[model samples]
Target: MDESFVDGVQGKPGSGLIGNRKFVISKKNLAAQNERGGEENIATGWHAIEFLLWGQDLSETGPGDRSFEDFVDGKAPNADRRRQYLTVVTELLVDDLAGLVKAWAPATKGNYRARFEQGGKESVRKILVGLGSLSRGELAGERLEVALNSQDQEDEHSCFSDNTHRDAVNNAKGIENVWLGRYVRADGSTLQGASLRELVAAKDAALAERGTRQIAASVAAAEAIQAPFDREIVGAKDAPGRQRIQKTIASLTQQSKDLVAAANAVGITKLTLVQP
Candidate 1:
């Protein structure tokens, strides 16, 4: 039930086939699923749902094409099981997000959100640490370098949908949103708060501007790359696509360094750029 099922939906296009839908997820539930804690919880999260939705990127021309009927009342083997799994997983996702919404809702008290909002410097340090760690280790080293070194499509972050490029762009956007202290909520409302950008600028405006530019450059580098990072690495021996990916990696690395500087500006002097 991995990616090979892509062949089943190749010719079909929306006859209860080959389309995508949205699902809300609970972060805590997601973490538990990923951790599994040496238990029976199979790795279930966005990628798990993505696999069930898109199947796999078996096609060189485009993304996966999973059929909705695979999970509906049908003659297909395991149809009932598939339908039940999808329903339960999606319900879990919705329940998780409901918890988040309650935690972060305006005027909410004594939850994670209140603690984050109240502890100013601690929250800022946490944000910088996350941004720096993600850029330096997860995105730059693990995700990009491993794929580049092996030229393996399976290393892609969104391999099922061939959407790793979008993932990179969106990650950079998230970094930007944190620095700018602005983000659009799931309900179409805007949320603003104390930002790292303002915090840095209070001490050194040039450093702040440099960090902003580095973030933008990282995103631009990601966007400039051609589609399907897993496929693009195949051309590393001849084509220029590899160079584009390399450029994006460099951009991410620099942005990560900038994040460390920003963290230092905020008095968190013990930060380290982890690599894994």
Candidate 2:
């Protein structure tokens, strides 16, 4: 008598319980009986119908229930009649359910495919852009190295071996100005070109003076090296040997400073000495 129960099993195949042949329940009859029953009684019948449709026990019966025995013994309602009843009921409701499922399939499939394609395209674009940037960086580094080397060659050709003192001084100043210009441009600084050139020239002159002093000290060091060592060198008391070593080290240091200054005047920023 439960209409919803009939609706639930509307199109499902059934096991025969009423006869040897298949049968289906009437939806109108089920609905009419449900309307006539008391509310509590209708609920009980609905529960029983659900149990039967889902292959559950109608009562609190165990696996050894006599109802199952009686059903198998051919003493119950015809199996075919029960089966046909369930089948017809299911047939009536399944069309609406199937239509609902069909309506959702296209949208779900379309959205999934769209997302998959979008993700794939984005991944490819990211890889291409990264490779492009890396290529550009390598090209920029090579260009910078070539520019620095070219600048060095031009300085050597134009500024080396001038006869007049004025020409030599002007050329050294020009070289210093060029170095400063490059530095300021590289650093994105806002210094005026004229001022930068003057400042760089002054710095170069000071460095040159220091280099001359270092060269003089180096000549002294060479002479000291050639001198013969005494068997017993005399010194003042109270760690005189340590004091003498310290004074010698200081003289050698002054010579190093003068050498560094001389190198700077010629725009030689680095020096490597190979000792034999």
Clash numbers, per candidate: 1, 27
- TM agreement with the true structure for every prediction: 0.80, 0.21
Model 2, 71-151: lDDT tens per residue?
243654444444455454455356545655665455465553344445753433332233222222221122112222333
Model 1 lDDT per residue over 203-233, tens place: 8899999999999898898888788677688
Whole-model Cα lDDT of every candidate shown, in order? 0.72, 0.34
Stretches of candidate 2 exceeding 4 Å from the true structure: 1-24, 27-50, 53-74, 107-276
lDDT of 2: 0.34
State the displacement of the C-alpha of residue 65, model 2, in Å, after optimal TM-score superposition: 5.3
In model 1, pairs of residues that clash are 26-96
Give per-residue lDDT, candidate 2, residue 73: 32
